[model samples]
Target: MADELAFKRWKSLEPGIRKKLESNVFCRKCGVTTIVDYEVEYTNSQFTLKGSCQKCHGPVARVVD
Candidate 1:
């Protein structure tokens, strides 16, 4: 119930905020800032972006503040 509401609110975030969040990750395995996709999720009352490194396919995650 509440989870769904939070998810919906996340979906309504501004495009610029999403873009900034999606672009601010460095891929350790690839040694580059190449994050192609961001999977936004809410956990423990915090939002996170789960993505993969485009060059090396390594896991990348960033906490949204």
Candidate 2:
């Protein structure tokens, strides 16, 4: 689930940038993998994406400034 403000900010980004961010997540089990089923969160003045890896269906997260 994404908070309202965070989701809004995420939606404001260009599609290409969003694609880059969603496709470039680090997963220990699978190295670099695309993120799926993600949620946007705003905390400590930063945006964090919490989701699962597309390859292995494992938990993954990416922090965006």
Candidate 3:
């Protein structure tokens, strides 16, 4: 799907769907988007993604897939 549609679909999905799609989520860290190696935790209707930037030490955006 297109990036916009993908993001919309992700947002429209239920919590269970979010859990299943966690593997596809990526971290927009540094100048590159990288997949997180560790498992993501979902709670309180929100996700706390723990990952680092691949190119720089700056923070990254948590993207859902």
The candidate maximizing lDDT is 2
Candidate 2 has an lDDT of 0.93
**Which one wins by TM-score: 1 or 3?**
1
lDDT by residue for model 2 over 1-65, one digit each (tens)? 34988989888999999999999999999999999999999888788999999999999999998
Model 2 segments more than 4 A misplaced: none
Put down candidate 3 lDDT per residue, 1-65, tens digits, no spaces. 34454445446778776555444444444344443433344444444455544545444445332
- Candidate 2 colliding pairs: none
lDDT of 1 at 11: 79
Give residue 6's lDDT in candidate 2 (0 to 100). 91
Query: Which numbered prediction scores highest in TM-score against the true structure?
Result: 2
- The C-alpha RMSD of each candidate to the native structure, in angstroms, is 2.9, 1.9, 10.6
For model 2, how many clashes? 0
For all candidates in order, the CA lDDT equals 0.71, 0.93, 0.47
lDDT at position 4, candidate 2:
86
Pick out the ten consecutive residues of candidate 1 with the lowest summed lDDT. 30-39
> Could you give the candidate ranking by TM-score, starting with the highest?
2, 1, 3
Q: Which stretches of candidate 3 lie over 4 Å from their true place?
A: 1-32, 35-39, 44-46, 61-65
What TM-score number comes out for model 2?
0.90
